[model samples]
Target chain A: MKEKIHIIKIGGSLIDDTELLDQFLDQFSGIKGKKILVHGGGKLATTLADKLGIEQKMVNGRRITDKDTLDIVSMVYAGSINKNIVAKLQQKKCKAIGFSGADANLIKAKKREHAEIDFGFVGDIEKKSINKKLISKLMKLELVPVFSAITHDKKGNLFNTNADTIASVIAQALSAKYDVELLYCFDKEGVLEDVDNPQSLIKTISEEEFSNLKNEGKLHKGILPKLENALSAVKNNVNKVFLIKETQLKNHIENHHEGTEIC
Target chain B: MKEKIHIIKIGGSLIDDTELLDQFLDQFSGIKGKKILVHGGGKLATTLADKLGIEQKMVNGRRITDKDTLDIVSMVYAGSINKNIVAKLQQKKCKAIGFSGADANLIKAKKREHAEIDFGFVGDIEKKSINKKLISKLMKLELVPVFSAITHDKKGNLFNTNADTIASVIAQALSAKYDVELLYCFDKEGVLEDVDNPQSLIKTISEEEFSNLKNEGKLHKGILPKLENALSAVKNNVNKVFLIKETQLKNHIENHHEGTEIC
Candidate 1:
């Protein structure tokens, strides 16, 4: 049996709140064993973009990354957010190193080539791109790796990528070497039966039950992608997956407390 | 005998031009043995700050890092500039990693304490703060380190620091294990005795001659601090320090070419 490694994706919304981030860091520090934290962009990037008069390109409500947008996102994601989180983790006694995928060629990506749309500098990560050897080396040194939503094509261009995708790709890639658990931690406690009711949390879901929830129109819209990411990890040989509450991270680590585990 | 390591500092002014930077990187990649590359900020940060309406804070003509300015600087230095350099180096086939000081607590700092000034986010790197073992490991793998001028206080505060100071400090710290050569490359080829005559270059300056030049007030005004930094590195036991032209990087590396070497 391989030693377990947790790849946790921290959602954008939880990062901007100082008090909550502090508490989250405090809890995250208690997680004993190897882990990695992947973080998404917060509202600050958009705000900076607006102030700079950079037009936001949205296609079907999804943001398109133009060259200018890529620069802003890189600044926000890899710069302030990544460094701040590393500092906070250090303060919490969790030694961590921040990385933009370009660093050490940790992730090599190909620019998104779509037939209809040009998503200027957005990249879809390539296969076998994760530097698992380097990562494993760092993990052995007991340093947590914190990654920003930035990647690079080895040819010489930076790309803005989705943090959750990066997390999932990394988990799947590492599954061969370690028993990996992919966790999507956000504000919600778990997958709720009723979207509005926190008390209507579902503790676990298998593929058969997940399809039933999808067919019945009972699954939360925001959680659809998260579940898909989790299911993909499971199918890819990751040992387990979870959709857990950020506030409950401490209990989840110490007590193996319940979250919406997907098998 | 200590192994040789070149800790080269690239001046900010040389970074913006693509053709020049590309050529410089190609030459840099040709360098043999262990190395590191530390870069300073360029006009992008100031331009971004101007666009964002963040006032530049200056104390007696020296830039002071207030919080808003620190945010912008981090975005420029650690974000686009750092990653862009990393990507370019990778394109040159020199595997490199970029860092802000907070990464892995590699360079812990303390917020500047002063009676006369409140440079909000400025930090002076603490002694014994360099992660020599981690850096040695990376060097052993032939991965060059590229550092941005941001250090954390370990208590969660990210700081804006002088890139030259960072280079000096790191060089001094690493001198015990390496015959370190600290290079500061800028636009000018070397220090010229007659400001208008390139042929009047001062190829070398000893400590005594340095004081004579200082007394004569013959050095260029802008180069004063750089020379001071080089002198301090020499004082701290760095094997050698050089101020050479970015375009002449290849010659300086392969031919034992002439530059303003401060001994």
Candidate 2:
């Protein structure tokens, strides 16, 4: 049996709230085995961008990461937020090390290519993009790597990558060596049948059910990418994948079930 | 015989200039064997702060690193400048990994304690503060570490630290296992007898001579701390210490001398 490793990804809402983030990290530090925390950019980047008067660039309704925005996100995501989290984890006796994909060439990304839209500094990755060998070696050194949603192309460029995709790809890449469990921790309890109903939690979601829900137009717009990423992980041999509430981490780890499990 | 390792530190002026920084990195990548790079924040931090309207606070002619300033510097130093350098170095085929001191608890610091002045988020470090064992393990993986001058207290606060002192102490700590050469690269030719004349570079300066220079008030204010750090490294058994012009790195490495060697 392979050693179990939990790869938990936290979204912006949890990262934006200090009290909640602190409580979550306290639980995260108490986990018994190896773990990796991947985090999304919160309102901090947008807030900083607004403060600096850098206008948001968009094309075809997709947010574009321009040079100025890339700089801001890199500073906020890879620098301030990443380091602060690492420091807090260290305070909790977790040997957390922070990283941007640019560090150690851990994740090499391809600039997103589209026939119509130029996404500026956006990067897209697959499982092959992760430098899993070095990551495994670092993990062997008992360091918990906390990654920011920033990646790089080997040819000297940093890009704004989707944190969900980062988590999915990393889980996929490490599946051969570990009993990888990928968790997407968010503000919501789980994938709800109704957007406004907290009690409408779906316990398990198969890709077929996910498709059926999508075809029925029941899933919200925000959850599309996350579900896609989770399904991708399950398809790619990840042992288990789930979308859970941020506050349920300790309970989930202890009880073996929480929010929506992706199969 | 212990393996030789070069610990090169670059200051703000070099980091601020793109072309010069590029040229220097090219030379830096050409360096053979084990090496580490410690970099200072350039005008970018202050520039960002200015644009954001954060007022600079100083007490008794010493700059104070309050919370806002600390946030700015952490982002600019550990985030923007550090990651950019690592990416550029990666472009040059150097396996560069970027870090702030908080990563892996590499350099734990104590908040600066001043008798009357509150230094806010500034941190002070010594030789023992560096996590030398893990750094050695990392170096063994053939990854070149590029550090930004941001540290943490291990109690959860990130602090603005002196890059020169960081370099000095790291060199001091690692000297036990490696034949360490500490280099402080700046815009200057070396420690000059006459600040205005580059030709007046002192070939070498003993601690006594340094004190004499200080007593005679010949040394400029900016170079004082750098010199003190250099002396500290030499005193602590670091194999070689020098103050060299940034562009002269390759030349100095090849010829075994190009700057003011501190003895």
Best model per TM-score: 2
Which sections of candidate 1 miss by over 4 Å? none
Highest-DockQ candidate:
2
Q: TM-score for chain A of every candidate model? A: 0.95, 0.99
lDDT of each: 0.87, 0.96
- Per-residue lDDT tens digits for candidate 2, residues B1-263, read 99999999999889989999999999999999999999998899999999999999999988999999999999999899999999999899999999999999999999999899999999999988999999999999999999999999999999999999999999999999999999999999999999999999999999999999999999999999999999999999999999999999999999999989999
- Predicted chain B of candidate 2, TM-score versus the true chain B: 0.99
TM, every model: 0.97, 0.99
| Per-structure clash totals for the candidates | 0, 0
Question: Which ten residues in a row are the worst by lDDT in model 2 chain A?
Answer: A57-66
Over B34-142, each residue of candidate 1 has an lDDT whose tens digit, in order, gives 8999999888998999998999888767678888998898888998899999999998899889999999888888888888778789988733878888888767767
Model 1 RMSD in Å is 1.5
* Candidate 1 lDDT score at position B43: 87
* Model 1: residue A186 alpha-carbon error in angstroms: 0.4
